[model samples]
Target: MADLAQSAERFRVIARGKLADPRIQSAIDSSTDRLRSHRVDAWDELGEVEERRSRAYEIRMRAIRDIDGNLERFRTALEARGGHVAVCATAEEANAYVVDVCKRHGAKLVAKSKSMATEEIGLNEALEAAGVTSVETDLGEYVLQLENEHPVHIVAPAIEKTKEDVARIFSKEEGVEVPPVLEEVTASARRQLRQVFFDADVGVTGANFVVAETGTVVTVTNEGNGRLVASLPKVHVVITGIERVVERLDDLPHLLSLLGRSATGQRLTSYTHLVTGPRREGEEDGPEEIHVVFLENGRRNLLDTKYEEMLACIRCGSCLNVCPVYRKTAGEAYGPVYSGPMGAVLTPLLVGIDQAPSLPHASSLCGACTEACPVKIPLHELLLELRRDLVDEHETSWFERLGFSLWSFAWSTTFGYRLSSALARFGHRWASRFGPGRVWASDRELPAFAKKRFRDSR
Candidate 1:
């Protein structure tokens, strides 16, 4: 919510907290390793994945290129199927749309799946502010709700917290002592959420991929919370970014195949729900009203540009697991809903570089994120582009301008570059003697420069 550059000091502090905590280290390492293995297993199951991944990437790119056309088609399809569609240009607009719908229907309580888009728009908070009680039905989200914290991982929001931590949180919630057994703790949350589901007046969710042909919104989750969140409530509201739409119904199976494989290392998540619209005539049990909110929220600017490819992201969060920075700081450091490399690029663009410019610079430019991306988003390259935008286009601080000026000067000329290289080489001895790199030193090791330059050695 705050400018990340201005908040850089705060982020450094958050990073320090994360770095100092041994529990965070262990939790991140253990969970990421397991996710890594799952991804490998999933990929192995989908052998010939390179070809499949490539095809998936092409489909998304084409869909993005003609996004306006596809979006119109999607809206038409949904309207034809009796779904109410609203286009929101900002998070505020989307939140307002949802709130108005809830108020009009006199919703007292709402149950939600893990909708990062809603989190991005602060939907639950908005509803709470409006005196409408909203419950997070996802197990991970339920834990976060009790703790009053944001999601740490896109896929597993509470990944940073262990069973012991969850048990303690639940103990506080139930007003009783609880043990650290995961199954017992999880079951307790499920029982409570099931009750909430039965009484919910509304259901809110995010679409994984929206099919333009059928005007269908699809959500994949392991816990089956999405099904309850979308099916039980009298009114169902789905929020999603404009980029999620694909060209046709057939393209969905291909993109979804890539999605399941990339996330959770599963051939398929336990539950995948696809809804075309509200329940039609003769429908047994379904929401009486269905609303689809298509949010632009700063995505249109990337169109016809190099960064447009980022729209292909399915939010599998594979990039977060492999991200060196995200591994330590976790998702909160991004100061936004989306985290990791995808967050690094998307946050600055959506929230504005002026609001959170440092996000783009947060990456170590490690290609692991790019490699892990199922849709082939060039995350590393996007970081460089953001850096360029920050320096040249955005209103940057004096220190950054001076630093880049000197950096550019040294890079352009042979003499300046060579001289700086020599000085850097000579400064190696003083590196440790100099002020502690405290921030950089925590996450990585810096090499000491040698005294002799390569050109001067001969």
Candidate 2:
């Protein structure tokens, strides 16, 4: 795994490099712009969008509040339907369980849909280490898999890769001339992946929402690949965060409504599978063995804390689409499986704030992510809380601590405050004469201090 600390330290430099690349900028700009516009249209179509968002938020909150009870109910309901549920408290245990399942099924070729939970636990790397061949069935995931690259976006994994880049990847992998046209490229990928699906002994997927009422694992996808991965293989494994499970079946529609619009701007995904359990005696098509692994990798830690609201996130990439910083740096710069605003709050909390110190400060506190969030997570406020935690722990630099200390002390004293303001005015005037030469001032011009103090004018 990449060292998140090292990656975060170099964030500014990496962002600068990515911003300099016209290809990266163009791809990110166009994709995010289109998604944002579609989301606007989709919300407009759904009359009472805010009301829906509030209802979604309430459902998620209620479910999480009684998470343990919900999980127990979900397990019992799923078991009654002949499905196996494994509650893993750690990533290592989750990966071990999946590997064990694969080994028991004698799985060689494993087809997978786009699963961030699996990525969170490094399941692909674990499977390969255990001598299992895991192939990503999602087109974006397949492209990244072939290139040995991580996802650049949550919903659209290969969002940063251009058609030319994909063509080159295909030509190198398949030993054939592949065109850069979108339709041809997609057809070619489908042709290649169809064989993998046929040969797959086990299929792995992530649930968008798990219904406790019916013991159904719900998955939504634009492509038919998610359906194929779940049904075609003899064995199916679902790895998802515990927060994904909702209490009632009816709660699904509210979340679905939010998820589709917030994620890809569709009223509903092309395919939505509600897998209750393994195939029964009379079943025509389905997996013989269905294993659902509910992963609680640091999620349980946030249950009653100030950060519990983070779990309300539905993994809709809407937050990322509107994040100013994410638009430029993309996902890789965060050095974690999850990225963008959600990642900034999540990765640090999961991996340890010390490991990803710069993540909390990466945002501009513009609240775009808060606005974009389907469940109204208040991501910016959470980020601010994390920053405060860092300061409380004395994790920040001495200079920063001292600067803030001085500011606080000055504000407490009227004379000190007035003197500090006068000094700031004089300094700004003096600095304006030399032009903005500091690195921080490269793109921004420092505003000149007010000609006369407010108090003086009064």
Candidate 3:
């Protein structure tokens, strides 16, 4: 987390390091390509995909526009169901509330489903520091937890890990030879986590969408671990961003339609858990108590702002699967929980521009992410907006500012443009050997200018 707050220099260095790792690159390529293909096939089969996307966009944007009202309604409805609601303004506040809950319950072990909000708040570390054992129940997350590594992708945390790597990690942990087979490794993880489910004192998860109308926290999972995490434990805690709340229970199917197809290419995830509240009087296995933590953490600040459309994002990770930069550098280069085009725009906004200035410039402005987004966020446009905001704040370096200023001036008039083009044609070879050009040309070849200009030939 400390590293996430460092300067752009760290991003550059880490990106360079990631670019050099062929093994990691291979893993990322395989996972992203497969996911991308799955999404295409799923959308094709679902017919009227564009209409569904439009409806999803409408649902999300409308919900975000009325976020305050929706949040209040959600609080009221959930509280009416005997659930506890804690609205936290910061990560520290959220963590403290969850920790307090754990302490009140004398909780020694916590089982968690996949939740980026928890990752954003460093919940596991906080719990460990408090002498509470927090285990990730999702298989991919469980693997990354064993390695003490963060998720590389939103849906597939261990996307960069191969079967051999999992076998090695599991074998090392269990003190037995685990085969590098998917079935065997999955069984091994299931065997280990099955006990944790029953023994865990508290269950924690992140809401994919919180229905304000019904006070239901919707979690979409393929592995069904989320169901166990929400039900088996005595106490259940949900931590999520305020933007997740929607105005109606009827809005779910429309949103889920896009989320499922875009995220994993399934019509719907295997387990779409709709938990309204804790156990009822006759319920045999559900949690005795439920707590919902609504984390602001800079999300509300985007309302009525240019970046507010960002809140409409359903976190499908479709942008990552198609992002050229992310496919190459992967998530670690972007730093912490979020990554890819969505992260590039959202991270700096959440953490502040100065904290992650490089993220805004990480994209190629290719617009693939915008096209791929389930809710149509115009992610590339947002990246451009962030870059403009960077210049407005003078956060960019003097050299970059000066260079862009010169380029803008040179290209403003035909005479200046012609003069600059002539100089570039004649001096490109020399320029490629120096300063920024040297760094840019280190891996890519500099194309020679043509002997005859198109204008002159015409």
Candidate 4:
């Protein structure tokens, strides 16, 4: 937030590119509509959406409240199963663990499934710096990897790219010419990754949930890449946030139901893998070794706080789909790995609120994210909490503070509110005199305020 001019220029470039994409509206409408519809159908079929929501929220709350105990128990359980566990307090520590493990294993080529935690830690960049070839196996991730861009959406990383854009990327890569059909694009990618996965020395992934009870990691994905990434390489590493660990194995189905409904609108994803420990002595299909790294980064500080419930998010992008600001600005404007309302709240919190001062203010406090969240995170309330942090933590600039203070006093005083309302109404009347409801409004109007203040009418 302090380094203003440079950050502003970066965001301006992102905004211009996103706003210029004519297909953005259609892209959002098509995917969000399908996702929302799928959620409705899935929940209705389940016949106890409310019941599941209640239980899921409670389960997450209980786990996060006793996060330390749960994490310790998880560590013990995972260790007991012959798996090694590492708890990292920062992204640097997590990256160190991965690089050390890869270097120890002499991993020259690495294949990875889609992992937000890896992105959060800039793992690929770190691995590349350490001379490891990290490949993105998930179709969408592969697209972004090819184009050299960050994911624009969660769940659907390449949502911003149309078929033609994808074709351009692949066509250039392959040095071939043809229509950029989805299946064709997929085939080309498959051909490219087939050898990489076959030859990789290590496979890395992110876990959706870590079941402490079973010492297992769960990953749900539509693509089969998660399975390949987990099973093929000699060593498999699962990177995830500490709060993704739920208390009981029984809570999985309830969360799985919500994740599918919220993420892709399916009752279930095509592939749901539950891997416990490394491969057993006789198992031929799974990896020979397994490692789980629970990353705290900054989550322990949120314990018992207002935002603790955000841990229950399950990483579904339902909130993103409905966020108007996210719709307009796209994910790059968030200036972090996470995007949309959740990103707006999470990026600042996990990274450092001071570095991303504008993120919390990007929202309109519309409460759409809260409503759309399958597990019911109060996203708007979280936004307010982040905003309050800026002031309470003294993260605000003098100019912005003065502006907000003036605004707060104006809206708080009845006399000031009334006067301002009258003046705004009068100004609108004067401006509208140019035509009948023909004011030069692009997105909204300077609608007249109430004819009289509420106190007067009452």
C-alpha lDDT values of all predictions: 0.84, 0.89, 0.91, 0.82
CA shift at 273, candidate 1, in angstroms?
0.7
Query: Which segments of candidate 2 are over 4 A away from where they belong?
Result: 1-8, 429-439
Better of 3 and 4 by lDDT: 3
TM-score of 1: 0.93
Q: How are the candidates ranked when ordered by lDDT, highest leading?
A: 3, 2, 1, 4
Cα lDDT tens digits for candidate 2, 381-436: 99999999999988788877987999899989989999999888888656555533
Q: How do the residues 1-458 of candidate 3 rate in per-residue lDDT, one tens digit apiece?
A: 22356577877888888899999999999999999999999999988867877888899999999998898899899999999998999888999999999999999999999999999999999999898999999988999898889888888888899999999999998988999999999989988899999999999999999999989999999999999999999999999999998899999997887898899888898999999888999888889999999999989889999999999988899999999999999998888788899989888888898889899988989999998988989899999999999999999889989999999999999999889988888889998899998988987888889988888788
Per-model TM values vs. the true structure: 0.93, 0.96, 0.98, 0.90
Using TM-score as the yardstick, the better of models 1 and 3 is 3
* Tens-digit per-residue lDDT, 331-361, candidate 4: 7787647888998888777767777777888
Could you say which candidate leads in TM-score? 3
Model 4 scores a C-alpha lDDT of: 0.82
Candidate 2 weakest lDDT stretch, 10 residues: 1-10
**Pairs that collide, model 4:** none
TM-score, structure 3 vs. true: 0.98
